[model samples]
Target: MNRQAQAVILLLLGGAVLRASVTDQYLNYVKPGLRGFLIAAAVLLLLTGAAALWQGMRTGSPAPDGHDHDHDHEHGHADDEDGHGHHSPRVAWLLLLPALGLLLVAPPALGSYAAGRTGTALTAPSDFAPLPAGDPVRIGLLDYASRAIFDQGRSLGDRRVQLTGFVMPGPDGTTILTRMIVSCCAADARPIKVALGGDLPPGIAGDPNEEQWFEVVGVYDARTVKDPVNAESIPYLRVVEAKAVATPAEQYES
Candidate 1:
């Protein structure tokens, strides 16, 4: 690898980062709050690449004959082994692989496949509060699970809750409403799910594994049992109504 190759790699990485940030695809992999940092990083990389390319192109004048040439010659061997050689480490070239994947494949966000493979736990707020007034109270799946398990569904008392998440097929031939919670990125995402019982609405009934997004209006079943896979209390919901919905731009819950 030469200076030009290094510069190109930097530019490719920078461009990919910028594109992800600008196009809102960064939300798929990481949080929205990282957009500014991603942009700044991309800009820095682009500048570094441009500087390298400029320096490489400045061959109009030869170096003055001096001890400087001899000094470089003496240290050339040392530099070569330390990544300052005409041929850089072969591993450095692999950096462009992610850029290529991002550009060409544009991988989809983590979906039901990832959720199904991981066991989940409910995360409740330290200070629980009553649901805001609404015909069908909209609540997060994690919050609901926590309330059902820890609070004995006291806060949920006869309230029809509305929840949104993708479908995760259960072993008992039931569909689960699942959401992935991420503190940073998809790599650390963990699934939080609620078992959907009673009759499901029309659109979701056709295929349990369809991985469709849905908004369900239901009340907590209040039947408590330890979840076999995760060893935590599984929250059950008696589905009163459900409807297919579009996947949100940001799929993961914080």
Candidate 2:
């Protein structure tokens, strides 16, 4: 790639980052707290690219060749007869593909396909605090999983809880309610799953589709099952009610 092309790539990459950071799109890949850093990095890249391009234009820099003609001339050597100077590897241009994808067609967050292939991430056992007072209190999948698996659902008690996540087909044609939890970004995301039992609620009308988002009301079930992929014990939720729902704006739990 030539210097100008390199600069353009920088601009494209910066624009893609800025576009994601300025909207909810960034949430699909990373935690909410990293927005400021992403914006800062994007601005830096844009400024650097702009400066390089401006300098090249103002100085009327030579061809895309990786050489400085004026310096070569001062050294008493004429420009290359072939008019082709050593250039960056052509493979570098491939970087533009991902940049373009981010700009024009950002990928969706990880869902059931990812959840089914990975083992659930369970935190080390710890004494969990009491769940807040509410019948069917809204709770995160990770929190519920940790409490149920490591803490044996002691903190859950008889209170009904609500969870929202995409559905994943589980062993023996069962359903798994899942959410991806990321420590940094999507690349490191791990599934937090709760096996769903009992009939679908009236609002759903049918078996939940794979990757379909749903809001489920249920009480923790003591029964556990092995995750087919990794044989890890997955906790269960006895569904009292469930309904199809749109994917949430922030799909991952940080």
Candidate 3:
């Protein structure tokens, strides 16, 4: 392809690279440590693309072969087999196909895929110490659970509270427990086993999946502690509402 064509291609891809780099959509999909690699790759691609554009424009200059010089190389293969001539750098713009694909079909946000995956708990060890002095704090079941099991003891003792999460597997498949687990950008969040306390909303019901989202209504009730795992150590929030909803990409990245 010609240099102008290559420049157009590279310009489009560079825009995508810049977008993916600045936005949470791509970075949140990656694991904590891996995000840097994608950024570096985008940078390298952008730079190399700029260089390729410069070379493509210079195509107007004479070539040693004295034949029409191929400007853009196809997908990095500078020459065809048997040393045959190739399409100009304009063809290299074809590389943008994959970039376009990724931008459109970006993988679904990590969502609730991370139910029960064990790893570092978010709570600090000091949290287990006697509960901090606060009137009422909104907290997650998993956070309370981890605290009960490992952190120091604290009591909610009739505190007004709010909780949110997805509907998780309960005693029977028909009866669901709503929950939310925040694991590294919600991509691997664990369920917080919230207690339902009120009427249901149209949007908040269903089987939990990797991409589903939910919000719940309820208060923290002391008697609701029945969970065998960490029941004694963790606090429970009594939920009054369960609503299913679609979260914007930015909303889920947290």
Each prediction's whole-model lDDT (CA): 0.80, 0.84, 0.50
Candidate 1 TM-score to native: 0.86
User: Candidate 3 on 1-254: residue-level lDDT in tens?
Assistant: 54556666666676676677667666545544556776777777678778877776675555687754443334235455435444453456668796686677665544333433322233554434343454345455455555434432344444444444444443223223434434454446544544343455543334444244565545444433344433322334455555566664443222
* Per-residue lDDT of 148 in model 2: 85
TM-score, candidate number 3 = 0.54
Candidate 1 lDDT tens digits, 105-223 = 77878888887667876766676787999989898898889888888888899999999999866655567788888888888888888888878876555467457899999998976
TM-score of each: 0.86, 0.89, 0.54
- Could you give candidate 2's per-residue lDDT for residues 23-47 as a string of tens digits? 9999999999999999999999999
By TM-score rank, best first, the candidates go 2, 1, 3
Off by over 4 Å in 2: 61-84, 202-207
lDDT of 3 at 228: 42
Residue 196 error, candidate 2, Å:
0.9
Q: Score candidate 1 by lDDT.
A: 0.80
